[model samples]
Target: MAAVRTNGERTVNRLAIVSVLIITMIFLAPIYWIASTAFKPRNLATTIPPTIVFTPEISPFVKLFTKRSQLRAPPSQEEYEAAPWWERLVFDGGEKVVRSGRGEVQLSGYPSRFMNSLIVAITSTVLAVGMGTFTAYGFSRFKVKGEDDLLFFILSTRMLPPVVVAIPMFLMYRAVGLNDTHLGLIILYTAFNLSFAVWLMKGFIDEIPKEYEEAALVDGYTRMQAFFKIVLPEAATGIAATAVFCFITAWNEYAFALIMTNRRAQTAPPFIPSQVGSGLPDWTVIASGTLLFLLPVAIFTFLLRNHLLRGMSFGAIRK
Candidate 1:
């Protein structure tokens, strides 16, 4: 009887492992395709069978870096001499025609867009998490009137279709003369991400024992000090997970970014779509860009998988 039960458990464990592997592949397949496409030549990217593997070409990366270096170099007398022709045709032609002693590829406009995204995402994540953490602490520690109702209201804000809010936000930014500014987009992202950050952090904070904070207080620490010195350290895992979530949400945000800023502050998502010319987009460029975007998120999640799992579980018991 014991042997029969042991065999049954082993079979169940094997089935569970197989199921997990299948689900993981399903989630990772698109990312794999994106990374694969990035390295492929433009011609090979669109093949019918869809090439799953290839040796990476360095041209795309070379093109990306070379362009960036040129953008940073100071203008020269020769560059000034061509100003008229440069003005007539635009800097686009001037940069290509005018060359330094050594040959270098011009930096693509995509990197500037990438920089804009990085700035907006990092700033938004920091602000959102900072505000959300304190708010979550308040909700967890101090019982306020209709707290559950308030929490529901906060969560419901996230449900409001981004499209619905976008038009008004666009108009507001235009009115304030912030339409294309990084600050404008940072504020928008913070507002959009705040609800999830607050809710997630609140769950984690609630699970922590109040006794720890009380002990700190008894030892002469003020409430604020106790929070920073005691509770915050224990909640480090949850905060890290929350920061990643906030960063990714801001990084991948497109609709608002597209409408809010044009050339000056465009992000990768809009930039990717714009690469499409006439009939077909440059598949290789698109693939490469997609891979670049996914790589950071993948590395981050993999490094913090254990903490992420615990944070996401919100202290739920598996057994």
Candidate 2:
């Protein structure tokens, strides 16, 4: 009987491992496809059947930085038909291209757009976290008559779809001369991220014992001083997690960034898709851009992983 039970436990463990492996593959498949596409040339990229194994080339990577005038256009039907049979077998029609004048050309304005995204994300995260932390601190410590109701009201702002309010916000931004500007995006993202930050910080603040603040008070600390010196320190893990979430949201936001800014403030989300190399919708450029675009979030997450883990584990251990 004991042997049978042990066998059953081993079977369950094996099943669990298999399940995890399947899920991991499901998540990893897209990333692998994108990375593979990035390394492949246009010939492999636009293949109708989607080539699995092929020689990798850096032409697509180089084309990403070249100017439109400097880049080669798609091959014409005549040009496609004229290719040698052996070359034609491996090279698809879409892969044909050359520099505009057979001369060098400079890359596009990805750096500027990247900088714009960075500014908007960092500024918005800081404002959202700062304002939300203050408001959450107030809500956590104070006993208002309708505290729960007010908290619900604050949360209700996020329940509405962003599209529902886009028009109104756009009009308001234009009237106030805030449209197509960095400050405009910063303010908009901060307001959108505020609700989540407040809710997360409030829960974090509530975890601390009131005795700590009272002890500080007894030692001649002012209310504000105790909050800054005592409560804030304990809430650092939660604050880091909240800031990461806000940063990612603002960093990846597209619809708002697209509509709000036309040229000066466009981010990678909108800008990367429109980049054309050999033809319309350059797959290589798109894949390469996407791979690069993912780096900031990856780096930010790595940096704050410790805080995030602590914040996540806090609730489990608190009781």
Candidate 3:
């Protein structure tokens, strides 16, 4: 009977593992397609039956980063040989890199848009998470009048669909001369993410023992000092987890970014799709841009993966 039970448990474990693998592949298939398409030659990108195995080239990435025009004529052997490898890739595609009157290479707008995304996402995440941490700590450690009502009010801001306020927010931004500006998006994203940050952080802070702070207070630490020295360290996992979510939300935000900013403050999410011009769109270039855009979030999450795992299970077990 014990042997039968053991065998049953083993079978259950195997089934669970198989289920996880299937789900993981389902989630990863699109990412795999994007990564694969990004490296494919231009002609192969749109093949009816997708090319599973092929020689990978960096030309799509080169095209993704540079401005190019259809070649009027093939480069002479002299021009091709003298051209750098990256330029040759462009030439081989029957396109020439756009250059200034002084022959300086002109770059695509993607890099700047990517930078804008980083600036806004990073800045907003820091502000939202920082302010939320302080607010959460207060709510967790102290008694307040109408605390439940206030917390509900905070959380309610996120209850409505963001699109409901889009036009009103756009008008407000325009009236304030905040349209098409990095600061504008940063402020909006911070406000959007702050409530979520506070609620999530409060749970993590609640799990920390108040006695630790009391001990610090007895050691002559001011409340602020105790917070920074004691509470913050204890809540590091929560902070990391909250920051990751906030960053991703701000990074991938679309509608607000689309309506709010144009030339100067556009982000990768909006800019990547706009690469599809009136002509036959370069799928390879679009795929390459998407693949690159995914890296910052992927890297950020990977770096915080340990904390995120801990944060998820932080308060699950009780003493």
Candidate 4:
């Protein structure tokens, strides 16, 4: 009986390992493909049997720089046709060139879109995290009538589909002369992120002992002082996690961003797809831009991974 049970346990452990390996590979496949494509030459990028490994090429980087100059010069129809395939691939008049295998690559849209995304994400995160921290503190400390119900209602707002409110928001923004503006997008992202921040922070704040704040108060620290000096320090892990979540959501947000902003303030998400024109999308450029776009999120997550794990493991351990 004992031998049979041991064999069964070993079999279960083997199955678990196999399951994890399969799931990990499934999740990593897209990232591997993107990284592979980013370094591949344009001709090899779309090749059959899918080029998994190749020598790094700098031609894509070179073309990215030169394509804009070529685009500005009006090519005669005959001259355009006579131009090298790479040049023709890169420049398509006013249409956005998604990818180019020719002369030098143009990168105007990517840089601008990246900057816009950074501005929106950073501003929104700061506003959401700052405001949510204070609001969460209030909810954690005060026992107002219907406070639980109020908290539930606040969380419910996040559950409502963003698309449902998008039209109303668009109309409201237009009425206030805020449409297609940086402030408009920032405000929208902040509001959306605020609900999650408040809820997550409130839970973290609640986990902190009240005695710490009481002791600080008895020692002459004001309520605000106690909060900043005691409670906030203890909750740093949760706050870091919340801030990362807020920033990522704001950074990757697309539907609202697409509907809200045009050429001047568009972000990386919408910008990438919109660049594809009458021909093949610029695979190399897109791959390069995607790799760049994902870099910050990857760094942020990696840096705060421990804090994120602790935050999510809330209430699982006593001490």
Candidates' C-alpha lDDT: 0.76, 0.77, 0.88, 0.79
User: Which candidate number would show the highest TM-score if scored against the true structure?
Assistant: 3
Root-mean-square deviation of candidate 2: 6.7
**lDDT tens digits by residue: candidate 3, 5-78:** 67779898789899999999999999999999999899999887878899999999999999999999899999
lDDT of 1 by residue, 285-313 (tens): 66766777767778887876765654454
TM-score of each: 0.78, 0.80, 0.91, 0.81
Clashing pairs in 3: none
Error of 4 at 27 (Å): 1.7
Q: Model 3: how far is 32 from its true place, Å?
A: 0.4
Order of candidates by lDDT, top first? 3, 4, 2, 1
**How many residue pairs of model 2 clash at the backbone?**
1
TM-score of 1: 0.78
Off by over 4 Å in 1: 1-27, 48-55, 64-105, 307-319
Candidate 2 structure quality by residue, lDDT tens digits, 207-260 = 889899999999999999999999999988788888887898899988788778
Q: How many residue pairs collide in each prediction? A: 4, 1, 0, 9
